[model samples]
Target: MRRTPHCRRAHQEHLGKGTPLSVIICDIDHFKQVNDRHGHLSGDRVIQEVAGLIARQLRAGDPAIRWGGEEFLVVVQASSGVAMGLAERLRSAVEHFHDPEVGQVTLSLGVAEILSGESIEQLLGRADGALYRAKRSGRNCTISAAGN
Candidate 1:
């Protein structure tokens, strides 16, 4: 893909009009342990399953990218509250998803609404930081960039 997404400019236009767009950063909790305890094959399956779950649940046209090994980033044309609600759904889905080989895998997510005049990088960083908070607070939960 390109350095930035084409929809980002669209997001900027909405931001220009004072509309909020939210980003959600998701990571598989204790992914390394999964790989160590099971195997790379199982770990890969876990990532693939989680990624598919997230991708399938988001808005049809929204961008759901594999941000890293076990991480996914989603950008949606919605408010922080809306995105947070979506994240919780994804977290719950992952929680209840039972992989025969990988067992149960949980997701921790961070959500951030684009601030006025904020760049895409800044928005994503804030979202990622919020995800880190969720990871720290334990796992299998969602956290918003605002306040906490």
Candidate 2:
């Protein structure tokens, strides 16, 4: 999907001003197993439902995108603490979400705040690292980037 010019400009503005930005990457736990047990249709439904829940919880300036299958990225114009709070809320929302077909679902999340002069890849890598940590520690939890 094409990102709107406004969104692009906003990103550029952040880059220009060297503003700190926070990002959260979230993924469902055992998503493939859910698909295998409940069928692809049910899996898709769960994904959509979780996406909606995350979207609803976003702040006015925040944006949430479906990064990939069973994965989502949320951008928040706030500090790392705010980003972590948002991630925790999203995790809780998904955990408590009700679906007749899929029942309960859990999520693993990674959060990071962009540092001055940091590249997008670097920020993403930090968040990805945190996400892997969350998964390794045990699914259904939130992990912030190391040293954040």
Candidate 3:
């Protein structure tokens, strides 16, 4: 699937006025295992259910996109601290989410705020890197970009 231009547009929309722009990269933890243990249909249901949970958690008008097969990207107008807080809340929401077929599902999230003059791709890269760290440290957790 093609990636959306939400971040770039948000960057352009907020650049000159000093708006705080943040991004969160969220991935379902051990999703492949879920597919293997359950089934593809079950996996799809898990995705849908998790997406609903995430959508309900976000503030109205926040953009949450399916960045990959089992990953989501959320764009927010908030500081790094606020983004981290949002990430934690999203994590907790996913942790507690239960599906009749899938039981419980968890998420690993990474958050990064835009740096001065940084491209949207760079900000997303940082968030993705933080997500990798969260996955490595252990799933079902949130990580902020290092030294942000």
TM-score of every prediction relative to native: 0.90, 0.90, 0.95
Ranking by TM-score: 3, 1, 2
Let me know the TM-score candidate 3 reaches against the reference structure: 0.95
**Relative to the unseen true structure, what is the C-alpha lDDT of residue 125 in candidate 2, on a scale of 0 to 100?**
86
Q: Which stretches of candidate 2 lie over 4 Å from their true place?
A: 1-11
lDDT of 2 by residue, 44-118 (tens): 988899989998898767878788899998877678998898899999998998789878999999999877766
RMSD of each: 2.2, 2.6, 1.5
Runs of candidate 1 exceeding 4 Å displacement: 1-3, 15-19
- In candidate 1 the C-alpha lDDT for residue 77 amounts to 79
- From the highest lDDT down, the ranking of the candidates is 3, 2, 1
Q: What residue pairs are clashing in model 1?
A: none
Better of 1 and 3 by lDDT: 3
Worst 10 residues of 3 by lDDT: 1-10
Whole-model Cα lDDT of every candidate shown, in order = 0.83, 0.85, 0.88
- lDDT for 7 in candidate 2 is 37
State residue 38's C-alpha deviation in candidate 3, in Å: 1.1
Model 2 per-residue lDDT at 77: 69
User: After aligning candidate 2 to the native by TM-score, how far in Å is the CA of 115 from where it should be?
Assistant: 1.3
